[model samples]
Target chain A: MLFLIEDAINGILMGSIYGLTALGLTVIFGVLKVINFAHGSLLMVSMYAAYWTVALTGWHPYLALVIVAPAMFVFGYYLQDIVIKPIFKAEQDVREPITVIIVTTGVWYILDNLTLLLFGPQYRTLQDNPLRGRMLEIGQMLISVPKLWGFAAAVLTASGLYLFFQKTRLGRAVRATSLDRQAASLMGINQYKVYNIAFGIGTATAGIAAVTLVPFYNVFPTVGVLFDIKGFIIVVLGGLGSIGGALLGGIIIGLIESVGPQFMTATWTEAIVYGLFLLVLFVKPSGLFGVRYDW
Target chain B: MTRRHYNKMAAAIVLILAFGLPLVVRSATYLHILVLLYFYAYLTTSWNLVGGFAGVLPLGHAAFVGIGAYTSTILYLQYGISPWIGMLVGGVLASFVGVLIGLPTFKMRGAYFALATLAFAEGIRVMVENIDRLGPFVLNGPRGLQIPPLKLGLGNLVFASKEPYYYIILLMLLAVLALTWVIARSKLGYYLNAGGEEPDAAMALGVNVARSKLTAMAMSSFLTALAGAFYAQFTLYIHPKSVISLDLSFEIAFIALIGGRGSIAGPVLGALLLRPVSDFSRIYFGDTLPGLHLVIFGVVLILVMIFQPRGLQEPLTRAYNRLLDRLAPGQTKELGT
Candidate 1:
């Protein structure tokens, strides 16, 4: 019973972080109306950023978020403005431009291989950090301190995002553009600017997720590939564009990965997750928390 | 001669050169590269049936290739079956899986379909990696399966020389290209084109767009699996990572798109252009910069998409027609001079 409880707690905590990792993907999808295939590469870039920040400064891992997030925001903003915006302009009539997907995929291959060339394939982890391997214990239970911090970060980020989207002027402009780009344009909102901001926000969240992961995860050029697929599944399961749903979906997957090993091999859980994803896709193409109407 | 005759003559010349090149290029290294080039051309052509004609990007065609490679290898290793026969069995099995996947996925739109296919392929790869044994069969898990080169000949499908593999893949590419040409003019071809461009309109016109897409998927999967068996025989190895990989799937799509999807000659042109670039880059800079080729590929993909959304085939084809017009002014003179 205690083992199960321990696993569940770990699952929830880890799951929230997974949700955080996928947050940027959902945000980008919500506004761009296209699945950002380069989203994983962005995560990878941010993780490297976080890794270097903490390693070089000898600061707390979370403190690295201050620098990484803003930097990623700028990177994503220009990426959209310069590389992707042209494709959007060409396919303005298309609700979801397939060519943009290909372009993002191109970005993915470039970013990942560029990193490989620059940093080599060797995996790096932050050693001797303040939150390296700390454990929290309460009544025969032991939990990872980094994961707890990750959980707080996920909740805070999601809530903060929710509020920003709901209350702020820029947030409303983004929402309006997402609802109807042409109509928003007619209302004098620069839809292109909104797109840049949304992409920036999304990439910034990936940076935040990277900071949380740096304390616990290994940093590598291809590390994002691992989470990239997971982010896709989580976003789909939680419902694409649903902030809370991403969190819930991540918890579900986290639970499966954590508790599933009790009865089967660790790898089988991967199959189960895939199976569940397909089931959701067939049964509810809109996703668990997504609206029935197409975005 | 008429323009049609000129076109046929051109095709014949290309074919003859393709067949006779192996005679002149006796070096084993170049032969190996040529064989792999033909192999990619064959794989990309097969991928074009669904991805190009059906207008949906199925990024997981590697799943079918993996299925074919594994089926043939396992049958040959355990059951003592000839790989030639195993190849057919693999093709059939892949077709079934393809249809099964296409059923639910064909209902989805662009991004959803792409994601679903990617997940399905990843799931299959994960399953293959985990299962070392399934009842009587041994998958060897991540260790993969290796075929011993004991038997040799056309019948066995294991060759001692690279020329045999080159000729075989070349023949397969020609056959698939012919098949694509035929399909492009057929009723099924028209239906597929319609469905791809405008599914709702196609359905309204009684095109049975879903069924046509599924049919194309089945055919594409079968052809792709044949290449997988060919790959297993040529390399004498079968592994989850190499045979069933996202990179292979993406490469196929990249070739199709860059060469111009939905066109018969696009895959061949793409393979011709991309294979040499990737191969030579890897050979020259592999040690110094391991992933430089992929970076190049990404840059090329971006550049081509940005400049020529229709692919290189369009410009090349137009140039070819202009050349033909200049050469064969006699027909125009007879008609109007």
Candidate 2:
């Protein structure tokens, strides 16, 4: 019973972080209406950025977010502006351009392999960091301190994003474009600029997720591929564009991964997750938290 | 001479050249490369049935390939069944699975369908990697299954030389291309083209879009599996990472896109162009730069999508027609009308 409780707690904490990782994907999908296959690569890139920032500066892992977030934002903004915008312009008539998906996949390949070329595929963990291997003990229960921090960070980031989207002028512009790009454009909103900003915000959140992960996880070039697929499943489960749905959906998956090994092999947990995803897709293609009408 | 006569003559000449090249270029290394080239062309052409005609990106075709390779390999290793028979079993099984998956996923839009298939494939791979045995069969998990080059004959499908493999793949490629040509002029082809462009319109016209898409998926999966079985026999190895990889799936899609999806000659053109680039790049920089080829693939995919979304086939086809016209002085139809 105690072990079950321990696993559940671990699941919740880790699941929230997974939700945080997927939050950017949902946000980008909400606005851009493209899957952004490179989203995982972005997370991988940000993890590397965070890893280096702490490695070089000897600061707390979370502190690297200060540099990584802004840099990632800029990277994403320009990536949309330069590489993806041309395709979007050409296929302006398509509600969701299939070409953009291919382009993003191309980006995924480039970013991952380029990192392999530059970093040589070695797994790096933050050394001499304040959060390294810290654990919280509470009488027959041990919880990872980094994961607890990650949980808090996830909640804070989620709330911040919600408020940003609901209250700010830029946020409203983004919402307007997402709702109806043509109408938003007629009302004088720069649709392309909104896409760039939404992409930036999404990348920034991935950077934040990277900071949380760098403390507890090993950083590597292909690390994003693992999370990328997980993020897709999570976003789909939570409702593609729903913020809270992403969190809850992530928790469900996290719970499966965390608690499933008690009954089956660790690999079986992955199958269970996939099976559940397929079930949801068949039974409720709109996702658990998604609106009935297609986005 | 009429354009039909010229086209027939040109096809015969190309066929003659293809069959005779192995005799001229006797190097084993080049023959091996050419065999692989034909293998990819065959795979890409099979992929085009659904990816091109049906216009849905099924990113998990490698799963079918994996299925074909594993089924045949297991049957051969354990039951002493010929891989030739095993290939058919795998193809039938793959088609059934394909139809089952397509039933639910075919209704999904582009991104969702792609993701679902990807998850499905990944799920299968993980399962294969985890389970070392199922019932009486030995999967060996991540260790993979290797076929010993024990028997060398037509019946065993194992050969000592590359020429046999080369001719087999080349014939397979030609046969698949011919099938594609036939399908392009068939009722199913028109239905797929119509459904791809406008699903609602096609449905309104009573086109049975869902059934047509499912049919394409079934055929595509079956053909893809045949290639997979061929791969297992040719390489004498079958592994999850090598056979059931997302990269293989993506490469198949890339060939279709680069050569031109929905067109008969597109996959061949794409395979012809891309296989050489990937193969040569791997040869030169594989050890030193490990992933340089993939980077080049990514760059090429991006450049092609951005500049020539329809693929190289469109321009190449036009250029071919122009050349034909120049040769026969107005015998050919107008180019790109």
Candidate 3:
């Protein structure tokens, strides 16, 4: 029972980060209606950026986010401006989404391979970092400091995103565009600008998730492959564009991964998480917290 | 003369060249490349069955490849069965899996189907990776099964030379093309396209969307398994990474997409054109820069999707028709058109 409690705590912590990862993908899908297969690669880019910042100059990981998030937002904005806008300016259909999805897959390969070329395939871990390797114990239960901070950061940013969506004019426009692109444009929302900003925000979320991750995870090019698959599963479970659903789906998946190993073999935990994902997809197609889709 | 007669003559000449190429080119490396090309041609052609015709873009086709590779290898390793027979057995088994997977997946559309299929593929991969725990003697998990080398014979399907593999794969490609040719003109193809292009319209027109999709998936899986079995026998090795990874899935789908989707010549031409670039890049510069070929493929895939969404077939066909029009007025009615 005590072990189960620890698992639950760990699950929630990791799940929050998972939620952050899925949020990037969810926003892209919500705004552009295109699944950003390269979102994981963008996360990889953020981690590498943070790694270099810490390695080159003495700075906290959180301090590095100040540089990273804005840089990433600009990059994503350029991506939308350069490639996505010309294509996405027109309305999308079923087949068009598949084509756009494949384009993101191409983007993934480009970024991932370039990273492999630059950084090599070897893994890097943070050393002497403040968020590295310390734990707190309350009674018989122990909690890792890094994950705790990561979880806090995730919650803070997620709420920040929630408030932005609720209050800001740009955020409102993004929500309107997602609800109906034609109708939104008819209402004087410049979908071109909205798409660009939404993509930027989507990529900024990746930067946020990456900062939270560098404390514990090994940094590598192909590391994004794991998050890519997991993010896609989370997005699907959350019913595509649903924000709260992404969080709930991420938590559910994390819990399954954590608690599943207690009963099954440790290796099968990955499989169990995916299995549960498929189960949710088939059984509850609308998602657990089926709230407003884009908002 | 009619354009039909001209087309038949062109086909016969191409067939003659294919049969006679081994006589003129004796380089083993070139033959190896050619064999690889034909192999991919078969795989991609089969892939277009579901991807292009049925419009269910599966990103998890590697499941069939792994299953086919493992089934025949295991049968040969444990039961001493010839791969010729074992390939057919593997094909049947893969088709069974196809049915099992397709039933639920048919309910999904577009991206949902693609994601679900990918999940299914990953699920199978995880299972295959861990199955050795139950009985290591069978699945062998990660170590993978290796087919012992054997003497060359028609029955054995083992070759002392590369020519046999080349010819066999070419024949398989030709068979697939012929199959595609027949299906393209048949009611099934029309139904597939209709279902893919407009499901509501197809249903209103009395097409059974689920049944047609399942059949296409079954055919596709069977052909993919045959290709997989052939790969095992040709390489004399079977492993999860080579046979089952999503990379294999991407190549099959992307090659078809790059060449042309829903066109008979698209997949073969796509494989023929791009496979050489991939093979040559891997052979020459693979060590110099990791993933150079993949980078090229990714760029090409994006460019093709953005710029040439219909693939190379459109321009090539246009050029062909223009050429025919210049040669003889009003004599350019093509087969597929």
Q: What's the CA error at residue B165 for candidate 1, in Å?
A: 0.9
- lDDT computed for candidate 3: 0.83
lDDT of each: 0.91, 0.90, 0.83
In angstroms, the error of model 1 at B310 is 1.1
Q: lDDT for model 1, please.
A: 0.91
Per-residue lDDT for B223-306 in model 3, tens only?
A: 999999889888888777788887888888889999989888888889988999899988887788888878888889888887
- DockQ score of each predicted structure, in the order shown: 0.76, 0.79, 0.55
TM-score of each predicted structure versus truth? 0.98, 0.98, 0.96
The runs of at least 3 residues in candidate 3 whose Cα sits more than 4 Å from the true structure, single-residue gaps closed, are A89-96, A291-295, B133-137
- Shift in Å, residue A212, candidate 1: 0.7
Each candidate's fnat, listed in order, reads 0.72, 0.77, 0.54
lDDT of 2 by residue, B236-283 (tens): 988999999988999998888888888888888898898988888899
lDDT (Cα, tens digit) per residue for candidate 2, span A152-183: 98999999999999999999999999999999
Model 2's chain B yields a TM-score of 0.97
Candidate 2 residue pairs in clash (backbone atoms < 3 Å):
none
Please write out the lDDT profile of model 1 over residues A200-280, one tens digit for every residue.
999999999999999989999999888888999999998888889888888889999999988899899999999999899
Tens digits of per-residue lDDT for model 3 on A1-295? 9989998888888887898888989888877777788899999998999889878888887788998899999999898788766566433554346677677888888899889878899999988887787788977887788888877877787788888888998789889987788799999998788988999999999998898899788999998988988998888777787777787778877888887789998778888877876776666645566543321
In candidate 3, residue A244 scores what lDDT? 75
